[model samples]
Target chain A: MIETDWLWGLLGGLMIGGAAALYLLVNGRVMGASGIIGGLVDGSARDQWAERLAFLAGLVGVPALAVLLIGGAETHLSGNPAVLILGGLLVGLGTRMANGCTSGHGVCGISRLSLRGIVATVFYILVGGIVMVLARHVLGWI
Target chain B: MARSLFSALAGAIFGLGLLVSGMTDTTRVQGWLDVFGDWDPTLAFVMGGALIPMAIAWRVAARRRVAVLGNPLPLTHERVVDAKLVIGSSLFGAGWGLAGLCPGPALASLGWGGWGGLLFLLAMLVGMVAAPAAKARIDRITQAA
Candidate 1:
């Protein structure tokens, strides 16, 4: 099955868009992934904890479900887990410094025409682009 | 019992969605898009799973008179293209490439409670604290102009 992934990309964008609306409709909040994750750390917010747990479980679990039904495995994460850990830390710091994750700021924020989101997302893409360059071109990390 | 819960739930779901979509693994994402070697469709399913519900929700929100959370529906209105936008986007991209995960996926990775997730989570905290101060300064300058 060889074909273009445009349909998938469009579909994904729309789904994410729909999520933006739903988050607004239900929670009156932007579906900013970074902030939600941040809320889980310090406070004893139980709902936050439970939903976060469930959602992360679902994120990993759903793939498992898919594999169970469809017989495919998760993509191989090639980097050493140690490297992955270090990468995760840097990303977290970046997200916080920027005020939202790609989903929150890049997708929903820009969609809303938020200046902050617009600015932040631009930096996000560019920084990611640059890092990709360095990792692959310079350091060969990618 | 109250409205605040929706914020938390929605946020969590969004985070989870990021994880399932395999956006957490930067290499996988790039690999899926890459035409070089092995191609992965994991991101495709992840996107589909999210869109199916997302499309439904968008319509629901569009039809609703008031949000369940008692907040106004989301809207967009802006055209202020400035230096901040350029600088910020570049920073984000560089960081993402360096780490192979963004904020959402990084946090979801943390659910495993591994040391890597913890480091990402902590760095994110540092960024969060710094953002507000920067925002305020930018707003002030914008207001002045």
Candidate 2:
């Protein structure tokens, strides 16, 4: 089961990329999750509010429907309140500040060879690995 | 209406992809980040696979001035690497390592992720609202320095 996880990841990744392609080719917008939501929250997306809302609706709604039909998917997220709060805050602020997240910078940005996207991806991955080591092994916090 | 519908369809596919890719699983994400410990390379495969279509899309988009729906295609013009990109990405990385979830999975997992997920989402929203102010302060401080 563990050995075959990569296959699932690849298949799913293709779907994700395909989705990005569809959004780009059809709607002419970059399929960036954080940017989409951030624009709405910050009022910068006032002009495209409806479009963003529709995208979010499907993002949240489809999974919800899936849960209803095939049982809930397990997240295995940290149960610690502090971890959740702090992590969530960082994710929100950081993605907004950087102007992209994994999907945006990683999938979409790198594919296009965007320098900013590439740089952001490199920094986050490097920092993420460092944090994982510190938290998981040294501090045993998360 | 057609635009909105297509956007929804794209979102749906993206969400489904997250679920199918096991990206919604925090443990797996954490494992992938766990370089010094037990490492899972599944995420690398996912990234590689996703790059294929997106790279092709960029190529296709390059040849077309407008999208299929008549909207002008997004122009990638920004190229500067600044403090915001580095600092923000680092902070985001720390948070990701701590929680093992990013914006996409954070939202996608909500349907089944229960209270923990909801808490994270709310906190994230609060952070998003606060970001502009934070960015402004950072900019001010950087300029002062």
lDDT, candidate 2, residue A96? 93
The most accurate candidate by DockQ is: 2
TM-score for the first chain in candidate 1 comes to 0.81
Error of 2 at A55 (Å): 0.9
What tens-digit string does per-residue lDDT give for candidate 2 at A8-119? 9999999999999999999999999999999999898899998889999999889889978997478988889999999999999999999999999999999999999999
Model 2 stretches astray by more than 4 angstroms: none
Report the poorest 10 consecutive residues by lDDT, candidate 2 chain B. Answer: B75-84
Total colliding residue pairs, candidate 2: 0
Superposition error at B1 for model 1 (Å): 6.2
- Cα lDDT tens digits, model 2, B29-136, are 999999888899989988998999999999999999799999899866589988888999998898898999999888888888899999998888888888899889
Residues B31-118, candidate 1: write the lDDT tens digits: 5443333756655555444445545555566677467757676543345666445554555566566656666565444544345555
How do the predictions measure up, each by TM-score?
0.64, 0.97
In model 2, which residue pairs have backbone atoms overlapping below 3 Å? none
